[model samples]
Target chain A: MQIRPLYDRVIVKRIEAQRTTASGIVIPDSAAEKPEQGEIVAVGSGRLLQDGTLRPLQLEVGDRVLFGKYAGQTVKVDGEELLVMREEDVMGVLEADAGTTRKAA
Target chain B: MQIRPLYDRVIVKRIEAQRTTASGIVIPDSAAEKPEQGEIVAVGSGRLLQDGTLRPLQLEVGDRVLFGKYAGQTVKVDGEELLVMREEDVMGVLEADAGTTRKAA
Candidate 1:
């Protein structure tokens, strides 16, 4: 089934962090924290205004974004674990040049 | 210290849910889930684009918004608990006529 978020909501696929540290020590899944990075799959049209106008979202599908560890609700869509959150829950989109080492705060 | 969110970030004050249910049952604090509603206290200028232009945020200070549970990072500002989230995290703004009973999904 296809899923479409209403309003300013977005569907994100979490990007798992690398299991190994720079020192090459591998971290087990049981000890690893959930990654705060994700790639946008779909975005809502925009926010519904009091005046009934729809405001477009700044993010586009395929943009990599960062969020708080606890942000968004985990949902299983088509057997895939995905996250659905409002645009505000997204901290910022990563530029292409931003390396993976950068952590979003 | 004064807090100013950069980019499309927003600072919100959570609006507590009503303790008493419609049946007059009082839910204790420990049993109460964190409310998904909030009032915007401050908003950032906008999101930064790759071209260096800033996109304005759709929300304004004092607007009541609804978000998913665990949508933002909680911070203590001036001894009060506040949430800082991206503008995209805000699902929708409540209209003055929208009653309090309407839960944001």
Candidate 2:
């Protein structure tokens, strides 16, 4: 199903860790911690507030964001992992200027 | 530490469960599902986007919101469970209708 997040909602595809690391050893899924970040997938239009006004969002798709451990409902689209959440849920987009970058799979 | 969420960031304190329940039998921590929502605490002043302007937030404190599971970072303030997540992380404010009023502890 094509679940479109309306009104400032964003869909994110979480980046999965290729392999588990523990003291330079590889661990299995049964022992690995769930990844807590994701890449933006789909985004929503701005929302209309209480004053009969509209508020625009600053974030865009493809931005990687960090989230709380227990946040966002899980879903899959076209066999891809995804999470549907509000644009506000995105704690912050990780700046690309930092050395931290998404590892290529 | 006072974690002020600037620029549309919101701090949420997850409401905890009073007693467990299941088929009339009380379930313990191991079986109960973690509540995937929280009450708004701190808020950011909204962000300035690429267009060099500011945007306002729509939600407010005391508004219970639903978030995707595995969203936001975990933090504690004054011995209370708090989460510093982006306002965008809030999937939606749970509408207070259809008998979904939270059971008071």
Candidate 2 TM-score, C-alpha based? 0.48
Q: lDDT of each model, Cα atoms only?
A: 0.76, 0.66
> Per-residue CA lDDT of candidate 1, range A1-105, in tens?
756999989999998866998999999866998877789999998777666777677678998776778889999978999999998777655553412121222
Look at candidate 1 and tell me the lDDT of residue B93: 90
Error of 2 at A104 (Å): 30
- What is candidate 2's lDDT per residue for B2-105, written digit by digit as tens? 44454657777786665545567766645667788788765665554544345656767678889887877775444556777777788978765864665442
Per-residue lDDT tens digits for candidate 1, residues B47-105, read 75544456767787889999988787776534677788888889989897755665532
lDDT: which candidate is best? Answer: 1
**In candidate 2, which residue ranges exceed 4 Å CA deviation?**
A22-24, A98-105, B1-6, B10-105
TM-score: model 1 vs. ground truth:
0.49
Model 1 chain A worst lDDT window (10 residues): A96-105
RMSD after CA superposition, every candidate = 13.1, 12.5
